[model samples]
Every structure is written in C-alpha cells, then in structure tokens.
Target: MATTTNSTVVANTSAPTQYPFLGLPYDIFHELCLYLAPKELLVLYRTNKTLYNLLKSADGKTGVDGKHLWKRVWQNSPDSAFPPCPPWMTEPQFVALCYDDYCQRCLRPNLLGAGQIWTARVRYCPECIKTQFTPRNPLEDFPKGPYLNEFINEPHLCVPITPLRVALGDRELVRDHFHTPDVARLCRAIIDASAGAGGATDLNEKRSSVMQQWRSQMTQCHEHAKLCHIWQKQRARRIRKQRLLAKRYRRENILSRVNALGYKQDVSCLGHRYQALQGPILAVFDKIDALTDDVIAPQVIAFFDERRTLREWYWHRLIIGVRLGYLTKALDEYRQAAPDELLPHPVDIATDPMLRPLFTLPMSANVPYPIFQGLLPEWIQTWRKRRDDLLLSMLTDDAPSLWSCMDSKSHKSHSSRSVTRSSASHPEGPAAIFQHFYCTSCENLISSAAATTHTCCYTFVENWRAEAWHAPKTDGKFPTTTSDILDSACAREFQGITGWSSSCLRPCAAVISDILITLGLNTKFNWSDVGKIEGMHLRCASCCADKTLLVMGWRRAVVHAFQEHQGVHLCWVSVPPAVSYKAQLVEHARHKLTKEETAKRTSWKCHHCRLPRAMDAYTKSRMDIHMRFTHCIFHPQQGRDYYAAPEGVQFLHPTILIAATELRSENLDAVFPEGEMFRNEKRVGFLSRVYVTNMS
Candidate 1:
C-alpha cells in the first residue's frame, strides 16, 4: 500500500503544465496587450498574479513605466478621443475610473456601466448614489456664520460638489449635491490642522493654504469631468450607429437569400410598406452578429413561408368582403325595385354553394357586376324554392295535418290552371305562414332572410388587417411552420353555420299555430292575412302575474313565449274587448315602414309630439309615440300624430337611376372568360382551398 501511494503521487506530479497563449515572447505579448481596450486589459490584469506582475511597475503598482502601454491601448481603441490621464492620477486609476463598470463602494458589476460622479472621482450604483449623497443647501444644513459664507462663496473648495439632474415637468433642473462622508472628513481635517496654530492669524493663514490647494485639485477635476462627459456622448452615438448598421446588414442578407428562394414578391406583399410582416423581421433586427446563411436561412424560409400563408388567408377574406359588399348593394337595389319579393340576405347568398365559388375566385380576378347580376335572378328563385322546401319539410315532421291541408289547396290551385307547371314551380303552400323563425341562442324573432344571418350562428371577420390575424408567442419564439394560428383565427372569423338551419330553429311555427287556435283563427293564415285581421293583439298570461297587461303582435308574442315562458308552451290569450278600431290604429302607428318608403324621405314628423324647441325634423321610420313609453299613444291618430310632408321628400335622380339600370343590364364579357376562370398564374395556390374550406 505504501508503494502504491508513492506511485500515485509521482503520477500526479508527472502531469504536464498548460500555459496557453502566455508562453509567447514578451515583445509579442506586449503588442497583443496594446490591441486590447482599457477594459479588456483591466480584466487581464486581475486574471492572475503572473499577468499583474508582468504589467505592473517596479513600485508594485501600474505606474509611469507601464503608462506607455496604456497610452497605446487608448490610441487603438474605437473611441480614441478619451481624455489623457491628468498628472495627479496614475494611468491605471484613470483607465479604471473611465472603463471599469463596477460600483466603487459595493463592488457590484453593472454591464451597462455604473453611474459616475466625475467630480468625486468615483462610480456608484443607484442605491449607493442615493444613500451616500446629500443635497448641498447651506440654509438647511449649516449655521448662518462664516461656514455658511464659505459654502456660498467657495462651495467646491469646502466640499466636492456634483450636479444632480432632476426632471421637473417638461424641463431638467440641475441641483448641487455632495458626498456627506467626504464633507465630514474634510471638515475634520481642517479643524485638526487649525488646532496647532498659535493664534487666529496663523490659523487663518493655514486654513487659506489648505483651501487653495483643494480648490486647485477640484478645478482640474471639474475640467476633466466635462471632457469625459463629452467623450461618453460621442461614444454612445458611435455604438448606436454600429448597431444600426449591423441590423441593416443582417436584414439585407436575409432578404437577399429569401429573394433567391423566390419569395421576393411575398416579402414585399407582407413587408413594412404595408406593415404586414413584423414579428420575424423584428426578431432579428437588433441582433449584432453577422448572420450566416446556414444559421439564418431556415428561420428566414420558415418565417416568410408562414407569413405568405397568412397573407394568402387575408387576401381570401378581403376578396370575400369586397364581393359581399357588392352583393349587399345590389340586393338593396333589387329590394327597392321589387318590395314584394322575398330574397335571402346577402351573406346567405355569398354562402350559397353555387355562388360561393364565384366569391372564392383568385385575388387577381376582376369579375364585373354584370356577371353577378345575370346570375342573381336564378339564384333568388333557387333560394325561395329551397326555403319553401325546408319549411314544408319542417311542417311534415312537426305539423303533418297543416302540411296536408296546404298540399290539398295547392293541388286544387294547380288543377285550376290551364297549363301544368313542374313540381319545382308548384303553387306556394301554407309554409309561408311560418315565415318568421325564432333564434334559440339569442331569443329574438327574425324573418326567414335574417335567420341565416344572425350573429349567434355566423362569424364575421372584423379585423381586416393581416398583421393582426396572428401574434407571436409571448415568450418571443415563433412557430416553425404550422397552421395552428391560421386555423384558430379561421375558426373564430370564418366558422360554418352551427344552428341556422330549419332543424335548429326553435319550434316557432307550433307556438304560432297554438296562438292562432287560441284566437279562434285558421292555422293556415299567411303573414299578409294575419296582418289584415284587425284587433288581433294577444296578451301574455304569464306576464299578467306582474299586472303589466303585456299585449304584443303575434311575432312578439312568439318571442315572449320563448323568452319568458321557455317556448315549451304558450301563455297567451286574446283580448275580449271590441276595440278593433283602436287596435288597427295602434298597429298602423307602431308598424315599421318599408325600405322603399324610408330610403331618402326626410319630412316625416309626428303631429302629437315634436322635438324639444320644435327646431329639428324627425325622419325616423316609427312615430314619435314609439320612442316614449310614457306617452302610451300606440293608437296614434294618422295625419294628426304622424304625417309625411311631400315637399321635404327626396328621390333618386332620373339620370342616376338610368345609369345604374344600364350598368346592371350591360353585358360585358366575363373578365377571365370560360377556360381561364380559375387559372390565374399569379394567384396564391392555397387561397382558394382555404377560402372554400373555411367559408363553406
């Protein structure tokens, strides 16, 4: 065991010593040391005893002998304009004060550099600065005597004063502050020196001499501090310029590589010009390294591809919005021309299978209005037929007896006609009686046209900007290449209809039929027939518990049944009073005007009521009685409570009307023609697919 221990010790001693770059000749080492900055040299000096001895002078401190090395390093530095060391301080001291980034008191390192009180020749952290400094206000701290006079006259000689910048409102104010400990030490020194004096004259002379020497040192310090402040500002500006150049260099290199990969157009489409692509570019904008192709190529490809995918998605939505806008305007004109016709909402038309493809055309396609105008008539016919079929199916499943009666009446009407029509054009059934449907989600009574467009079932794209569509992860990492963001946004903004179909609608028809039976009216009554019946108001029995006497039309009664009574059963009863005249009057006054009547009319006014001061005109569709509940004038007298003045009314100009009509009828060739319809070479590949999948 003793032999083995000796052998182990010898093996440990035999291990070779490693000296890295330090083994270089003194001349080479000195040249390398000159290349390092003052901060780097300071770091090297503290690394080991060998380097400290090599760089230090014979006096065992970095003194005059080593001053030349520091001077060469300073000359080679990026900011060579740094002021030379003053005669009172050594080169090492000046370099450490200017470049060392640690608090002198606490010794804590700050990479951003500790705050310097150049007048005091010290660096301090924020905590040390607050605790060590005292505001130099003579009236607050000193007696009203010679000491106060000395402070007011020669503050620098009495104590080292540093200016503290303070922000006051819009301006910056500088107040003199001093180190409390330094002030106390200086006062103690002055007092101790004066104690040995024989008389007042000698003591005054001694004090004057000490004050003069201190004042000279402080004056030099103030002048050097000013130079240092200017050097710091210039250095900061240069560093900022270098960083900005590095950022531009990296951005240009990445964009060039992306352009080579055939994404120049995509980048332009989603770049800062439109403010579309920000995340990936901003992620690398502040980077300082010269990014290599291998390191940045994959990230650039992933970022641009993902951004391109998002841009395509946005373009799809944009095209859909534009098409929907046109369709809405066209539908409004159609309704104005033919008020009796029942057309589906523009949104529903956009979602139709045959029409949806037209809306999903590539972004480059410039489809004219005439094409949609030509197809609108047939689309409307198909929509009405489908709506009738859906209602018929609903009645068959829920109210077979009502369906049978309507079918028989329809067959009889068909036989009465001399020409036999196809089943697609069969006579309309009693399904029109159930034109109004109830939304279970929102509990609102809506017409057939509005049922499919209800917010409860459909999602609207509110944010049109592409940049807002998706955001980077909070931790600053972006997804590599994935559709999770796009899918989530599409799920919110382009959802398929969830509960707008006939099967999903609340059983409003059954409730209306029950109400009809209660009122002793035929269940086969159409909307117009029901509207023609005078004094047809029904009161909610459930609401009567509050003694409110809530009477409403059949539509509102259906809504109340669902909202207040859960729509399982109705608690409605007909009013027994013979007040048909009064009921008719109330219905007329409360009835909302048609779109055709309210389009541009500006002379509507209520005779019974006027605006405050009677200065403003009232052009709202309903009478003024509708706006005030306390008025209780639902049965407003026509021409007395409400009248339409002929003079103030306006209509579309004849020339504008003729132009619009001609534009609609004008037969321009299809923009893309027959075979080229969906083959725009510049169109994004995934756009049509994404649109169809999300919108359909």
Candidate 2:
C-alpha cells in the first residue's frame, strides 16, 4: 500500500500545472484588458514577469495592436478626456508617467497627487525637485561658443521651460526655469551631434529638427498636464464628500442608538462641539464603522459614567475650597481680635473630627462657614489644654526644681501677696511666660499662643497629603476607596497631626531652662520681664567676631544657645544698650525689605554709583546700602554714598521703577536688591523674570 501511494504522488507532482486565466486565448485576454482602468491595467501588468512580457508591445514601441488596446481602454475610462500619447513616447510609458505613484529619480513609492509634475512627465518628491531642477536665465547661463547665438535666439525651443509665478512686491512675475539634468543633456547632445557633422549646415539641420520636435512635445504635455490636474482635484473633492457623508451617517446612527438606550439627556449634555465630551462619543465624529448596539452602547454608557464621576469630583473640590476659604477668614478674624489665645493650626483645624466629614460630603451637602466657625471655640479650648498639659509634663520631667518652684507659686494664696510687690521677683508657672515655648523642628522660641499654630512638624506632611488627595494617580484615576477610609489611611501614613510632638515639647523645656541659667536669671522668670531689664541686650560671643556684631532679643539668644552651642556653656555675653542699639540698626540695614515697604518709601538715592541716563532713583529701604555692594563703595556714609533725596527727586532706576509698578499691580515678580551672599545674582534674577513671564 505504501509503494502504491508513493507512485501516485510522484505521478501527480510530474504532471504539468495550468492556470485558468493564463490559459484563455489572446483575443479573449485583450478583450478583457479593455475593461480595466489604467491603474488596474498597471497592477495586472506587474503581477509577474510573464504578465509584464505579455502586456508590453514588441520592439518596445507603440505597436498597432498594443496602441489600439490602450486607446480603447482610455476612451472607456471615467476620465475620457485624458490626452493621447505623444508621437515620441510609447503608450505604456505615458500611462505609467500619469498613473504611477512614485518618484522617477529615487523610486520612492507613494508620491500621491503633489509628487507628479505632469508637464515634465516625471514624478519627483520635494527633495528630489530641489536637486534636479534649476532656476535659469537665458542671457547668463547660455555657453560662450559658436552656438551661443542660436541658443539665445530661442532658449525655450532648445530646452523645456516651466513657468513659475513669483510674487514681487505688488505684482506677479513669470520666470523661466528648466530641469538641471535635462539642460545638461540638451547641451551635450548639441556638442556631440556637431562633433561628427561634416559642416555647420548639417549640424544646424539636426539641431533644428530636435528643437522643433521638443516644442511640439512641450505643447502636448502642457495640455495633458492641465487635464490631469483638473481630474485629480475633482477626485479629491469627491472622496472628501463621501468621507464626510459617511461620518455624518455613522454619527447620527450612534446617537439614535444611544438615545434608544435611555441616554438622550447624556448625549445632549455632551453638545455638538468636537471636544465637548472628551470621551468615546468623540469617536462617532471620525469613526467609519457601521453602528451596532453591541459596539457603541457600552462605550456610550462608560463615557457618560466617567464624565459624571469627574463632574462630581470637581464640584466636591470646589465646595471644599470655598468652605476652607471661609474658615480661613474666620480664623484670621479671631486671631486678630484675641492674639493671646491659643488655637489649632490651620491644617489641624481642616482635619478636625467635626470638619473632616465636610470634605468627604456630597456636592449637594451644604458646608456653611458657621459649621466650621461653631467648632472653633471648642477646638481652641481642647487644643490649648492639650498643649498646656504636654508642656507642663515636659517641664516637670526635664527640670524638677523649676517645676516645683512654679507649682508652689501657682498654688500659693494671692490674698497674702501685696499689690506693690513686683511679679518679676517671684517665680511663675510656664503658662505665665509669653513666647517662652521652643520648637525643636524650627529651633526657634515661640509663644504658647504661637505654639498652638506652629506647623514645623505637620507642614511638609500635610502639604504632601493635600497634593496627593487633589491629584490623580499615575494611571490618571482617582482613588477607588471610600473618602473616609482614604483620608484615614493617608493620615496614618504620616503618623497623624495631633498637636506638637514629644521631640518639640521636651527639647523646648530643656532649652528654656538652659537659657535661663546662662542668662543668670531664675528659670521661672517670665520672658516678658527679662526683656524689660536695663542693659539686658545679649550677643552670642561664639558667633560675633572682631568686626561682626550680632545682637538679638532674649528669645533668639535662647535659640542661638540651643542650636549653635548645644553642648557647650557660656556662649553669650551682655552688651551696653547704646552699642547694642547701633548693632541692631546695622543688622536691620543688612536685611532686605519687603516689596510693599520699598514701594512706599521713594526718597532714597545713591550718590556714589552713577547709572546711565540719570536713572539713579532708589527707595529709602534700598538706598541705605546700595553703594556698599552694587558699586564696591566700602564704608558708605549715610549722607555721602547714599542718602534720602530731596522731596522733588524721583527714583527712576528701570529695575526699581518696574518692580514698584508690578508691586502696585499685585504682580509677584518685583525685583529686589541683590544680596552679597549669592554669587550668581544676575543669573538668578534672569531665571526669576523668565519664570514670572511664563507663568503669567
């Protein structure tokens, strides 16, 4: 059985194969080719070498049979007006020149409509056109030889010229230009044809014949090119109209289906604008596929659902922002009215038990200011007591002696104390001292009232959480969990903001005790009382050098001791009030003023530094030491190097004037004087100006 199967396979493989189409008679094939369009005929011709050889004419010229067949095909074409092939060219070559979508020089495919230069009988891309064509002037470019006169008499007949309309001022001027390779070929033909000629008469005859034939060919090509251009434009318009009709049909079908699905209002809400919906509904405008319920229904539902969700999220945020704004205003008013009362930090207040739910509520829910304002008093009392207890505990742990003294004094009877007795002579509890609390995070002394709103510990973490909550995730989706659960998870991630931490409270009490001992004052002495003592001005001996004078209040003195001289003792010394006052004035001079203050004071001028155009005006806050660094004038005297100008003098420095104007306009890019500490102040200023311009 295996031997019989092998024999059968061998016999089948050895048999000759047959194609039904190729087997047709030549007369039937030629008849069928007549019905095919020019483009389709070209496609059939390229199917294989057999078809290519069969379709081409003998002698590679326009044979009578082949020309008849091509002429019949063109006559029956949709564009029957297509011009006939010129006598010098074969029908196939002309067809390929008009129908092929490729550059003739580089052979790159897909040249489309703009690529073919029908008059030139060539298809070239923009890049190839640049290299192959040249703008010419017959008078300048004609060669200096015996044939120059003939060339000058009629240059258009010698070589084909493409007329280009160039805009010059108010009119259009037509210029003659020719293909570079074609011009070279024509000149070489003239030279070679004359080289072998017996006399000038014969050469002239040959040249005349060639030129006359080209002139006729150019005329025919120009007419043919015009027809091709019109046909291409008409075809483009027809295709565009068809596409538009298809798009409209698809869009209407999709909308009707969506409405049948009970989404009429949703579709109407999306509106007719292209970018209104910004969802799958936009696909209807461009998509060409047939509308089906299975394909478009789910897309319509999902798009509207997502849009509704985004709208709700936006409304919720707006409500939260507005309510928070109201709460902020109320808090500011309360703080100004009673500056001494301790209140919770703004961030802490935002996340309070009573107000947190407001952030997570639906858009329809009302969150009036009274809702937030009503809870402020309770929050203040609770937070104040909590902070007081924590500070007291820290004091008791760090300094038992000081705590006992303050405790005893508080418990003592007030009736027994005389009215004339000074309160500074007796010790008081930690609560009595104003601005005595310290923050280890900022390494600064703060008041008990200020401590309530001190944000050193929670500022960074709270800012991060706010940004994370407001922004979407990497994949552009909001959190899927419940708002309350998400809020709690975020809070837990940052360990929660529950007032001041132990690190701040404990270090605060210890630093205060250490500062009291260094100042030779009782640990229980109130900071307010210590500030009033005569000649109590203190400077850090460790930070102040020979010429450098550093003077500050007792609060800063305590901070300086804790931060700079943490483990070491005896870091500060008392200075005379007069010297301290001078040092304070100098220190104030070194500091930069706010833009508001700079705009208010304009009498300042710099005498030592001369700017161009007399633009020498400066603000009083700025001119005090502008000469010291700006112009390298050392030891600038108040009256010589810089001083307040007379009432009539106006500061006109461009930078200063612009800064003042922007400040008045509430623009934040007001330029200020460059500090001596930064080396690249000019670069910094340029970057700031660029940033402000971009933002605006």
Candidate 3:
C-alpha cells in the first residue's frame, strides 16, 4: 500500500528492504543515521526519484518537513551560556571559534596566579573551541539600571574591575589648564598672591590678575588631564597587576603565616583558610612606592589652586580617602590641608591679619600658627610629645600582649570553656544562675600569658610580671587620673571580649556580653561601670525570683521590660516643651490663683504592653525597675555557638527546612547512594555513617 501525507512519503518498513539500494540490516541503518547531521539526513530523504516524487507533490499541510528544514537551527542551537554565535554578536561561528582560541590561548593563563585563584585548568573541545563562563550576570535581559539598584550591589560596596581611573585616555583631562610651563608659571603667581594679602597692590588689579591666572591655569589643567589619561591607564595596568600579585602573594604569605601560626591548609579542611583572607584586604591600588616622591606633591599641586576651587577638590577627596582610609602620618591629614609647599600657593600667612581671619586648620595639626593667634604653647608642646610617643610606640619591638598571643592557641584549649551554675542568694531568681566561669588555675595561666593583662592582675605570678610595665618616676607637675586608667582598662576588656568571641565560636558575643554586664552579672561591674546594678528599685540578678530566663521569652516585651528600670518606670523618655499659643497667658492666670493651684497631670502607659497605666512619677519609675528585676528573660548562658535555630525560638520555619531529613535522604538516593536504612533513625546521615544503630 502506498501512503502519502501532504508533500512527504512515509517510510513503512517491511521486514527488511527487499529492493537492492534499500537493503540493509536495521542496526546498520541506525549506525548510518547516527553519522548524519540533521541537514544531511534531510538531503538523504530527497536523494531517490521515487521518494522525491512521493514527497514533492504538495507543500501544504506537511509542515513537519518545513520544521525539518530548520534542521540547521536544531543542530546549531545550544542551551549553553556560551554558543557558536552569541546573540550580542551577529556572527556566531566566528565568535565561538575565536572564543575557543581565546580561552585556550589567553584567558586560562591569565587566570593563573596565587593559589590558582587567578587560574584554573579548563576542559576544552579542540574542534569547537569555547570559553568557560559564569552565570553571575543575567543573559537575554535589558541593561540593569534605574530601580534595578535594589537587585544589584550596595551603594558603597566595591567590586573588582581593571579600575577605570587607571584606564582612561589622555584626552580625558578636558578641564585641566596646567599642561604648559607658561600656564604653570602663571598659576604659580596667582597661587602666591591669592595665598597672601595680594602684593600690596590695588585690589582691582590683583582681582584681574587672579581671574586671568585662573583661566590660563584651567586650560593647562584640562590639557594635563590628557597626560593623566595615559599615565592613568598605565597606572590602572599597574594597579591590576598589583591587585593580582598582592592577592596572590598575600595569600601565599598568609598561608605561610598560618603555617607559622601552625596551620597547614588541608585539602579536606573547610573554614580557617577561607577566614584568613578576610583581614583588611591589603590595599588593592598600585604598590605604595608606585607613587614614589610624586604621589602627593604633583597631584596635589595640579588639583588645587590658591582660589581653593581646584584645590578644594583635592582636599575634599583626601578627606574621603581618609574615610575610605589609608594610614596617615598625622590623623588630621584628612580634614585639613597641610601648609607645606606641596600645598598650592604655599602660605606663611601666620603674621598676616586679613587672611588669618577666614581660614584655620583643624586642631589635629600641632603646628601652632600665629594665624591661629591664641595658643598657650604648652598645649601644642604636649600634643607634639604625644604624637612622638605614638610613633615611637609603633616602632617599639613589642611582642603582642598575652591576649593577642592567645589568638593563635589550639582550638581544643579554647573550646572546652565550662559553664558554672551557682546558687543565687535570693530565692526569687531564675531556677538556675549560670556564668561561663574559668578555674582560678586557668585565669592564672591567662595572667602569666601577657604583660598588659598581668599589670592589671594582683595574683602571685602577676606580682612578678607587673614589673615589666613599671618605670622609675621623677616628680612631675601632674598625676594621671583614675578615670584615664579606667578608660584604658575598658578598652582592654573589649579587646579581650573580641578575642574570646570569634575564636571560641561565640558569634553573638555582643548580646551575650550585654546580659553578663547588665542583668545577669554577679555584681554590677564593667571595666568602666564600677557602680552596682543590684538596686532596691532595679530589676536585677539579685531581685528576680524563679524568673527562669529562657531564650524563648526573652524576645517578648513583657519579659524584656524587667531589664530596663526595675518595675517603677519602664522607661523615661525626654519630652520637648509643649507648643501652645495660650501657654504664656495660662501660666499667668494659674499664678494669679496662688495657693490652690494644681500641678499638671500627664498620662503614662506600660512600656512592655503599651497598655495605659497610672502612677506618680516616682512610683512609676519604681514599678519599672521592679518589672525588669522580676521578668527580664534574657540569660547570660544563651551564646550563639550552634547551627540549629536557638532551641526554643520558632520565629521562622521556612519551606526549605520543612522535613529536611527526609529530603536529605531522597537527595542521597538521587546520587545513587549505596546503603540500607538504619534501625535507629538518628543514624541516617553520612556524618554518622559508621556508627552502629541500637534497634530495640
């Protein structure tokens, strides 16, 4: 039977082809089909006169062949991020072939640098030749802009690029006017006159000279901007290399340091090395010496003028640079311009009357200028001495104090901290009072570990270690205040807390420390606050009875209100004076009433529930203190050191986490895991692979 559909002949194979040309085993036909591209297969369909006659009669409804005509589209279309032809590019084959050549020849080697972060081995197809790509960018989308910022990076966040400031062309300095020597000389003259009281000449002549200098200088500045363009590109190239090398070498050096710190990055280990790179990213600009003697001097001169217009750009940017920040010889270098000759139109206007009236440098500079006009000299001398002391201290051969040294300790020694629960003197307290207490012996070890901390210790070993900080004193005009000593002590306390939290796997150190120093403490003590929290009117550790500070209730306002001000007044908020047009007249009329005048009454509410409550000011405050003492549910013991949601807080139950264990098992099976279900359900994970299950 002959069957035709539209313009195509349907091949209805009998047992095997009986005719001479069509005689082939079914397996052989399959093999031949495999060797043909889709287009070639279509061509094969038209080869025979019998087949063509059967297929060529109609082109109407047999659009399957028309679909087949798009054989090239099917063969060439890819679901890959990169393809033979990129849609961004009109020519696909050329781009694909070139990309393959680029990947094999150029980009792979370029990515090679410290720790293979710059380089990774690539799998390539020699025939097709293609580059590997990342999916961090969106494909087939409109350009990201406008309101798209919410979907992009944060405002001040930096990203890695070759740095455009380093890559611009010489023609970029359109506003620069200081390109020629003549223009520079004119700028210099204008800088000098504007810097001082204008050469004792007529004001109008000086003003004309100043404006002429500005225009000429602007031209040179614009021309010089082009010079910066070329140098900027070179500088940008330098910056790229510096960034790459610094990242590479720093990692190498850090790994070296970690190794010296007794760390070897095990291929099997996950975290510590990841954390090493998180330190202040060793600056990503060009090398420090790349600027050489010219870094501040010439760029400063070019950017600023005596009129402070161009110059203020440099000053303001320098301050922003300070905020972004680099180390400075002087701290005030950011906010104020220095008076060195490097600064535009260098002025020694100390003795001058007119100029001194308007401009003054910030106090960070200890240079007591007569332009400031009123300095006692001793205060300036004291500041200079302190600056010298700070510089000398930086250069001092100081081994890190004991707390700093403790940072590199073995993980086990730090992890086994004991939580000591003590009986409360008051019965009204939580069922348990817990403190992360150290053995006296362990504390003794900490004291002997560092001189700075030992100086504050009064123990036997510390009595000897205390000698390291003492110096023979001569009679002086003043004695250091105890307040200053307390301030220093407070900084060390925070430093200790910082060291303990991160390395000890305590992430929520701030909040935990707040509880320890405030409501849960044995005594009212901060290195700064020597006073007591256990007041009669205050909600404190000493007052709460069976309060049972649980992490669950701590988030509730009813519970947390107890920690604020005892039970008296829940909070005391300052109110601004009332604005009423008739308040003055009302006050006068009230005064006219004399002895029977009444005091103004104000309404108050409960801080915890926002419910209306009534009390006099004194009684209100007392009630607030009592409430905090009785109900503050936050505990010192709830440190964040685990992965699971803090036991009782059920705020978020995301779908991803719902029945996670079952999903995990399904995922393992999808990966073709070879295992049987254990009788003990807890023994289900890869982490628990070898553990025997106790089936009852």
- Cα lDDT, all candidates: 0.54, 0.52, 0.27
lDDT per residue as tens, model 2, 322-423: 665676577777877887554455445556565467555766877787866777777667656666776555545444333222222221322222123232
TM-score of every candidate relative to the true structure: 0.60, 0.51, 0.15
lDDT digits (tens) for residues 13-113 of candidate 3: 33333324677543344334445543344455458864343223332231223322222333432222212222222232222332232343344432322
Clash totals, every prediction: 1, 2, 54
Per residue, candidate 1 scores C-alpha lDDT tens digits across 210-280 of: 66666687888888889888888888889889988997787677777778888776756643433444565
TM-score winner, 2 or 3: 2
Name the top lDDT candidate.
Answer: 1
What's the true lDDT of residue 688 in model 2? 16
RMSD of each: 20.4, 17.3, 41.7
Point out the worst 10-residue segment of candidate 2 by lDDT: 649-658
